[model samples]
Target: MYQKIIKESNENKIFQYLFKSKENFVINDIANALNMSFPTVKRVVDILVKKNIIVERDKIGEGVGRKARVYGFNPDFCYSIGIRITSHSFQFILINGYCEIKKEKLYNIELDTSSIVDSLEECINNFIATLNVDEKKHLIGVGIATRGIVNNEKNFVEFSNTDSFPLRSLESIRKKLGVPVLIENESNLAVISESILGLGQKLNHFVCLTLSDSISCSTFQKEQHDSFSFKAGRIHHMNINPDGNLCECGSKGCLGSYISDKALILEFKKFFPEINDFDEIFSEKYLETNFGKLLINNYIKHLAIGIRNLLFFSNPEKLIITGKICKYKNIIKPELLKAIYTPNHIFYRGEDTILFSKFNEQTGILGAAIFPIVDSLF
Candidate 1:
């Protein structure tokens, strides 16, 4: 059993190295890079080749010794389903071994948050049923990225930004779907997605701040991440103001209460009773008014406060801002950075200190999709 574990570990390292570099490597080079024995590397390479996860693509160092066979990752060996559950939709993506999206579906039906477990199962099973027979056979697992404190080991969510409270066991969904299932906080998943697929690539330390229905923060360091830590990365309730508005978490002056979409909408409804929905705040007719100016200004002010606190604590290599609010990044950038800026850090170089994703709407699902691929490897 110990030997098997070591072999699997070596296989994982070699595979990840090849996959990340997107380069062809021979057994000797892989062994040398990974500090594994040549025999072990050869064994793992053979297994991966047999499993159709990698292939001999070319020859290298033709004159140095004998021509060494080079191998590269095979993207289509298997695929996984990734889902992000929002209040109104089940966002889905099918990603191949290479983490390239193959198919995407947005189930627009409203979720019955009171029965999220049943709704989730129905959405997943129904999505899987739409796949072709070949695709179904190649499906490896399902990954869920949710906006909440998720205990993946226990497969239950502690709390969600949506009305989902005390989520039921996901093991039931796994059994019914008849496939492996992994769940992660959408914030962490978004950071992971950025690390693997976006501007955060090759970065060991960074923070992802997502401003959606509520605010969320996820940090990545060189150290191992414990996805089930429960309390890890839960910064939405931090007290940034002592005399500010109240939050649903029963706290006054919570950071999330200042800039979350729901917060903005609630505040807007005070002046215009019929006003609801964060999207409506962007209408040109409304945004050109004095109320819009005040709201946007307040959002930038509080956003800076939250960001300053985050940077002071984590001091990450970069700060990635993603979510629906990012659509207005340009409008907010000037004021937002000014409030968070200092001579030494935060935004010393202005916009360079912050990175924004081009694919705002899909960040959560993309990260969720990559979770299954990461789970399969490690």
Candidate 2:
């Protein structure tokens, strides 16, 4: 059993290495990197190749000597479906093994679980019907990215402010879809996406801050055991201000209350009663006004406080900001940095430590889709 565990560990390492690099590697290169014997590496590689997970991509060297074959993961080996359920819409995406979106569909619907599950079934069926039989054979499973307290181990959503979707709803979706289903907190998935495909890719320690209807944070770090671990929803309820406004969670000055879209909208209404949507609030017409600047400044100040608290606690190498608020990153980033550098706080990191997410709206979905693929390999 010990020998088997070690062998599986090596295989997982090799798979993760290839998946991350996206480069074709020869047996010698993998063996050296993994600190394993060439024979053992070759044996594992052969198994992966036969399983259609990896393929011989190219050959190096001319006819003068035996050409070394380079291998890489086959991008079409398997596919995953990612579903993002929000307060007003459902986003479905079909992703290939390479984490590329093959197809996507969006539906604006009521925020009830029954409606969502019904819509999801239709979407999955329509998506599957579009693929060729051979391509369909590669379909592995589905992942649902949601907002709220998710019991990932049980594939259950314990609670959410958006709607009343119970744990059994996940099982219903799985039974109807006839595939393995995974349910995870959307913020957590966003962190996963950043870690795998965005700015956090190479970082050993980082934090992801998502500002949407509510504020959320996820932290990633390499543990003492040399294994990666993450904690989701750690910063939402953190008290950033003691005398600040009340939050939906019934707390005063919570991070979520200060930086969420709802908070911004409420603050905007105080200055510009006519503003409705985020676009209007962030528009040049509003931004040029004193009220707009004031609103933005206040928002940035509060956000900076929350961010400062995060940095003080985690001291992460990088902080990635995602969600709807990132659209105003150009205007907000500088102010946020300034707030952080004020005399009240002492932060040594440069401006480069902060970054906006690269994947935009698809970040959560892509992360959800990649979860099963990563789980299968590791």
Candidate 3:
């Protein structure tokens, strides 16, 4: 009975206390902060250290009797693999306990599920081969963040109309890999990491919207316990304009239909056939061109509408714009600001805090790499 009680307590206490800590802490500090007895906290810390779950670092004190040891999650005790599979490429990253990427590699692979799995497996195996034999013992599990509908509980890709629908499960690949695997929507994972570890760390509520070739939103909520978590935001197929061109997602005026970089590229091609790339058209000289201003205006207007929808629903403390869209932030900021200044929202009275996603191009990969550690730690 005593053992049963201790085991149950361990589960609830350890995670609860760690979740409450902003960062690493000494035993005494944790005890004092949580108002728990020193001996109890010390005992728990010792047990955790012995289990290789938490780490101890010695700290020197100027006026103390004995230097206290600070404890942190034993980042090196385990390893996690995160892969971001996108429509255009796949990026694999190996992260240790401290959320540091020990190794990272990227490859361009076909978007087909089977081909992606094959390429990813090759990369993982190659990475493992390169690791020193001793380090292999620390590998824990793998996490994958991908574009499209993911059945989180089932660890499967439900569908990705970007390529096909009714997609087959990723379970077969996971089984061959022979480790616990987690598959999540790429945008959801991005928000989760950004909220817990990235710039959103300080905000209680926020929306992280990825404006790549696709537009998706995710929301972060602060729990009563003070831990911040994220959930995927709404994804609608509505068009940006009733008269606008149809989207691949079968939407008439969806944000992706007009504001996405792909959308802009297509528009530029139609208006300026001589332009070969979006990057070229967005060059410095183009900024002075009437065409550039027109592109920026329409892009900002569509984005503003989409962001407005998100704000109306989540009432986020901040809204983060990420992906290729961030590159044109200087162009879009003024227009986005103008739209937000006008009152369409009724629930919140003040201005919404707007932020550019600092993670930028690394958001998907970094967030995916940190997923396993975040999962285990929290």
Candidate 4:
């Protein structure tokens, strides 16, 4: 029993090291970095190669003691499906083990359009049917990203703002598909994706502030036994003022009343009243106007305050900002950072403790896909 435990521990360390690696390595490299003996690294590498999780990419060196084989993590060893659910649409992505999106599709949907649960199940099963032979063979599971609070214990959504979104536990779908099914908040999923595949890969703690069409935030804390937990997507509704503007949640002074999609649209329409592009909220034409100036100043102020609170409370190694707001990173991200910058503060002085996700649009589903991969392997 003792020997089996140690063997499994070694296998886990080696597999995770390879999965998180961006470059292929030789046996010496793995042994040195992981502080394992050369022989032990070779044994684990051979095991992973046999499982098809790692593959021989090339050989390195010559003329010395013979060429050394280079091993690469093979993402194509398995696959998963990620689904993002919204009141207006369902977004889907198929990803391999590496978490790179291989396929994407969007379907316009609404609660009033049909029985939300039935339609979604049918859609997912239909999507599965379209996979090729190898894809179906390697597919591991499905992950659903939703705004609702997921009750994984019961396999149903317990709370949702839409009130009519899919409330049925996806366990039935899991049975039909013959693979595991999981659900998580979209913001939590985004943070999970970052932990597994993005800047937070090596970090034990972090926070992700997600800005899709809506605003939400979640924190990541790696627990013992290789488990992960996230909480507080409702951070958007944290009241910043007691007497400020009304939020859609029927509360005044909520942070969402100031910076959420509806707030931005309501504020922008007061001036432009014309059709608006989300990017234009930061456009030169918009910001130069008096109303835009006030709007931006307020946005920067509250954004900084919210971020500062998150930093101090969570004390994460890094803070990841994900959303369409990043498209204006050139203007918004810098200014927000500057607002929070303090002369004596170490984190803000130059280190990239705060970071932006590369592609805001993709992380939700990508994160959704990675949840199951983490569940199965790690």
Candidate 5:
């Protein structure tokens, strides 16, 4: 059984090693690192090279012996499409094997099951028309990130608050697009991106809090005993205040009610009726106002309360905060740290446990693009 597991994991181990390192490696080095025989490593490398997943780069001589050929991943060998669907817009990005965006387009359209499928077909067709024949041949699959519970097994959305978006399977979109489709919750996608490519790369256990149009959290833990674990989005509904504002989930005092984009906008409009967009509320001119300062203070307090609850429950090695709220890192981080570091809450650790997202807005889409590649490897 142990041997079977190792045999099954060999390809994934090799791919992960090559993906993590920036430099090329000879077959011998790969064998040594992976603790596999030289012939076995060479066989795997040869297969990958033939598949265009990796390529032989250059030869380097050691002493007076023959030079050894080094192999490296082929970043442009294939591409994937990543789509982020929200109530107000859809963001489409094309990423190469190296997980870099080659092209991106954003469309502001009201979302429903039928409209999303139609728009996706049109956008994909137009986008593919722009690519050359060689680039077109490299197209592999598509991954979508959205703001709700996704039944990955059925490729359907279970429920969502995006106005009038239907609860339906994605088979229609899959047939129209003619590619493998993967759908995941936006917050889960963000955490996956962080775990593989962002601040959580070195952490085996961490919590990600995303403050976007809504607020959500994802906790990642390396399996211990394999007992069933709670899913990530459940943390979004954690109760923070008993008599606080009512939430769309039909609950009062939920954390999301205090920190979501809609909540912040409502708070801002109460002070400045002239404010038209959420982006304007974050402007330096607006933030300088007394009302803006009050809003900031309230936001920080609630955000801190939510983070404190997460720390106590999960005890994660790190807590990463992302999304639109992070744009005000300068104002948010200080007050957040101050609130969390109080003597009574010191047991949850200090500022060292916290980190702001590195990828910012692109985190979810990039995660979507890499999903296929990572899934194939593992």
Candidate 6:
């Protein structure tokens, strides 16, 4: 029992070191950091390295004497392929071990059945052609981020309203692509990316609310294991109003029915039918126009109500607002704060802070890049 307990404790210590440190450590450094014997630490390192989770760095300096090699997560051992397929465009990126974009491509494509797989293949082939032979072999897997109900387990998408094709057959694309693939609902992927590297980094629990015309939420709960991995995506489609308009998802009074980008655009068009382009509808010069201010104010009101409904069950440390709606944060900060503070439950300290995504529009791409970097660490 004591031996097993000691082994578990050592494993925990190793995890703690990896979680907190920015730089890599050799066996001796780990031993010193953990205040354990060198041989014991070396045994732990050997186990982790054998798991292909951590990597031993090459020895430096020419020496006849014993060389103590540096060791850390391999920055070149794995790569994560991240693909973000949205209504307006599709983005694909190849991330290297260091969580950097080694190669990337973005283009708009028609969301159709025949075109979907072809587009994905073309994007992958084009991106792969740019890489030399050695880099091609290091690809660990591909991750697909798309809108609608995605089956994470089978890498199948159950449905997508963006197009009339069978996107649910993404597994076939994976087999053709010749790599393991992970299909994540886009909103959930967004939250995962944020939880790992964005505003949600420090918080263990939080809800990422996509404030675009397509409103959705992704929640993250850090699983308490030997490491820092977490469970993500418990989306609840709560109705914002019973008498509200119908949503694209075929629900009435859904939050998306009131505050989705389409809803906002429809609201604005009704007021200013002459404005067709987004730039004109939300132009800086147009803010002085009565219609512009009204649109902005109305948007904030609906947003506040939507947010209030989210906070009903969750007491997240922070509420991260992303997508196009974040553009209005500066314009509606005062009112947004007021709405969040209106409720005064005993548990609701009203300390819920709001922040914009630092990575902003590039969150999906960057997050895709991080998957490989994180895999290297694990």
Show model 6 residue runs off by greater than 4 Å: 1-74, 113-115, 152-156, 161-168, 226-237, 250-252, 269-283, 343-347, 369-377
| RMSD after CA superposition, every candidate | 4.9, 3.8, 4.9, 4.1, 3.9, 5.9
Cα lDDT tens digits, model 1, 1-378, are: 000111246677777677666667778888888888999999989999998888888787746697878888888777889998776778888988777888888888666666777777887888888788767888888888777777545545765544444434677887876778877778877876787778787676788888777678887664443222112376778898888889888879999898888888887777666777777887776678888788878888988889888877877788898888777777788888777885565343344667777668577778787766666665
Residue-wise lDDT of candidate 5 within 320-354, one digit each (tens)?
A: 89886666687778888898878665564667998
| TM-score top scorer | 4
Error of 4 at 11 (Å): 1.7
Quote the lDDT for 273 in model 6. Answer: 80
So what's the TM-score on candidate 1? 0.80
By lDDT, the better pick of 2 and 3 is 2
What's the C-alpha lDDT at position 374 in model 3?
62
Q: Name the top lDDT candidate.
A: 2
What lDDT does the true structure give each of the candidates?
Answer: 0.75, 0.77, 0.68, 0.76, 0.75, 0.65
Better of 3 and 5 by lDDT: 5
State TM-scores per candidate: 0.80, 0.86, 0.82, 0.87, 0.87, 0.75
Tens-place lDDT per residue, model 4, 92-149, is 8898877778887887876442466677787797788778888899999998887656
Lowest summed lDDT across 10 adjacent residues in model 3 is found at 1-10
TM-score for candidate 3, residues paired by index: 0.82
lDDT of 4 at 60: 84
Give Cα distance to truth, residue 115, candidate 4, Å.
Answer: 2.9
Output the better candidate (1/2) by lDDT: 2
In candidate 4, which residue pairs get closer than 3 Å at backbone N, Cα or C atoms, i.e. clash? Answer: 155-169
lDDT of 6 by residue, 1-378 (tens): 000111246765775466445367777777877789998888877887886657877775466987778888655656777887776667888776556677777877776655677777777777667776657777777777665565444544544454344444556767875766665555666666786667887776777776543555766666554233333332324676777777776767777766666677787788778766544656776667887788778777777777776777677777887776565556767888786676564446464467777655556556555553444344
Q: How big is the positional error of residue 74 in model 6, measured in Å on the Cα after superposition?
A: 5.1
Q: Over all chains combined, what TM-score does candidate 4 have?
A: 0.87
Candidate 3 on 143-224: residue-level lDDT in tens? Answer: 8777666654444464456542222344555676666666666777777667656778777778788876666777767765
